[model samples]
Target: MILVDSSVWIDYFKGVHNAQTEHLDALLDNPEEELAVADLVVFEVLRGFSSQRTKREAQTLLLTTQVVEIGGLDNALLATEHYRLLRQKGYTIASPIDVLLASYCITHGHDLLHRDADFDVMETLRGLRTWPH
Candidate 1:
């Protein structure tokens, strides 16, 4: 399964039409591709919608995919460890949330589809798989 990150989802909802969004669109079109959304990603995407209607629509769209629940003690500890490791490697992630997302993806063996640079860093340092692989 591929975890769709909020970065790509945001661009897709806005009809941004970039490579990442295009890739997401293609994935949505293909029945063989399994798509998922981490709970944090769902919150990140839905919370940004300005209107209730839009938020509901966004929720509906996200509901089509599997919702991966993260944030248990084990996952949080793993995320913290990954963050420390990245820091020791002279990398500073802007959001700890990204660490949690990456950790969840790593643990579940799900490839991520993201436009965020933080995920790229995670991919390099932690063996996080990315789509279009």
Candidate 2:
């Protein structure tokens, strides 16, 4: 399964064209590819919208993908360890949510579809797999 991160989703929703969005578009076009959205990713994407109509539309679209819960004690612990590892390596992710989400993907063996640089850093240093692999 592929975990679609909020960074890609936000840009896709706003009609911003980019390589990641383009890849997401292609994946959406292919019925064979299994895509998932983390619950925290859903929250991150939805919280950015101000329009009720747009929010509802986004929610409806997001529901079409497999929704996966991104939290639990185990996930949190792994995320903490990953965060500490990164910090020790002199890299710091700005968002706790990103760290947690990356940990979820790493543990689940799901390739992440993201546009955030933090994920790239995680991929390089922490073995966080990403889409287009």
Candidate 3:
């Protein structure tokens, strides 16, 4: 399974042309491909919805995707270690949420599809597979 990050979705929704968006679109085109999204990802991506109705619509889209909550017992220790390791390397993750998601992907053996540099750095810290789209 692949965990999609906010960057590619943002670009796709805004009609931004890039190698990343094309890659994402191609993935979506495959009939058998499965896409994954966490609950926190919806908050990050759909915060732009201006009205309650729009927010609800965006939420509906998100609910159609899979939701995985990270950092219960098995992942928290790994996440903290990832946070410290990335910080030591001087790569800014910018949020605890990112760390949680990255850790989830790492522990679950899921590849991350993202253009964000944070995930790039997290790969080194967490040994998670990343698909830079």
Candidate 4:
């Protein structure tokens, strides 16, 4: 399973051209690729849209894919551990949500699709798998 992060979803909805967005586009076209969005990602992406119509459009499209629940005490605990581990390795994750997202993917054994540099670091240091290798 590939969990699409808010970073890629935001850029995808805005039609921003980038490597990650392009990769997402390809994944959307492929029937074999299983893509899902975490609930936290949905919150992050939907709250950014100023227009109701645009938000509805994005919501409708996003809802077509499987929605993964990302909130739980277990996930939070794991996120804390991941944060502390990264900090001990001389890295500081900027967003609590990013740590949670990465930890969720790690524990669930799902690959992530993202445009954030922080996720890249998590991939390297914490074994967070990401799409496009």
Candidate 5:
């Protein structure tokens, strides 16, 4: 299973292509792969479609993917811990939502599919694995 980040979904909705986001769509097309989205990702994606029809389409598209919410004592603690560790490693502390999303993906042992470099720090410093191709 893979935890998809908002960036990829946004780019896909906008029909933009990048290395990682393109790979993410391709990965999801594979029958063997399963896709998941965090609450943050869902919120981000919903904003892209203002028309009810498009939004409903978006909702239906998303329903095809599993919803994965991550906000618990363990997730909170890991976010805090990961924040400190990332800070200590000289990386800028990102938004709490990013931390929360990353924490969720990491804790669940799901490979993240994202184009932004923000996650690379987590993948490098934390043991967060991402889609390679």
Candidate 6:
């Protein structure tokens, strides 16, 4: 399964014409490709929409994908470890949320579909996989 990141989702919702959005559109059309989303990603995407109608629409669309539950303690520690390791390697991610998302993908053995550069850094620093293999 591929975890769709908020960065890609945001661009998609805005109807932005980009490679990442196009890839996501293709993935949505392909029945063989399984898409997933984390709670944090959902929140991040939905929270940006000020309109209730848009928020509902986004929620409905996101619900079609598998929602990966981010559990406590163990996952938090793992995220922290990932962040620490990356920082030690002289890599700085803009958000802790990105680390958590990468940790979730790593823990679940799922590929990530992201437009953000931070994921690229994680892919290099760690073994985080990105879609299109």
Top TM-score model: 2
lDDT of 1 by residue, 51-70 (tens): 99989998998999889887
What does the lDDT read for residue 70 in candidate 6? 67
Give candidates' CA RMSD values in order: 0.9, 0.7, 2.3, 0.9, 1.7, 1.1
For every model in order, what is the number of clashing pairs? Answer: 0, 0, 1, 0, 0, 0
How would you encode candidate 2's per-residue C-alpha lDDT over 1-133 as one tens digit per residue? 9999999999999999999999999988899999999999999999999999999999999999999987888999999999999999999999999999999999988999999999999999999999998
Q: Which residue segments of model 2 deviate by more than 4 Å?
A: none
Q: Rate the local accuracy (lDDT) of all candidates.
A: 0.91, 0.95, 0.76, 0.92, 0.81, 0.90
- Candidate 2 total steric clashes: 0
Evaluated against the true structure, the overall lDDT of model 6 is: 0.90
Given candidate 3, what's the lDDT at residue 55? 69
Report the poorest 10 consecutive residues by lDDT, candidate 4: 62-71
Instruction: For residues 1-133, write the lDDT of model 6, one tens digit per residue.
Output: 9999999999999999998899999998888989988888898999999999999999999999889876567888999999989989999889878888899889889999998999999998799999978
Sorting all predicted structures by lDDT, with the top scorer first, yields: 2, 4, 1, 6, 5, 3
Q: Candidate 3: lDDT of 84?
A: 83
lDDT of 5 by residue, 1-133 (tens): 7888888888877778788667867776886888888877788788878799988877787778888887777899999999899999899755677788888888877888887678888888988888763
The predicted structure with the larger TM-score, 2 or 4, is 2
Expressed as tens digits, the lDDT of each residue in 69-121 for candidate 3 is 77486777888888887778777688777788899998888988887888777
Per-residue lDDT over 79-105 for candidate 4, one digit per residue giving the tens place of the 0 to 100 score: 999999999999999988889889999
**Better-scoring candidate (lDDT), 1 or 4:** 4
Q: Which stretches of candidate 5 lie over 4 Å from their true place?
A: none
Rank by TM-score, descending? 2, 1, 4, 6, 5, 3
Model 1, residue 7: C-alpha shift (Å): 0.3
Q: How far out, in Å, is residue 103 in model 3?
A: 0.5
Deviation of model 1 at 44, angstroms: 0.3
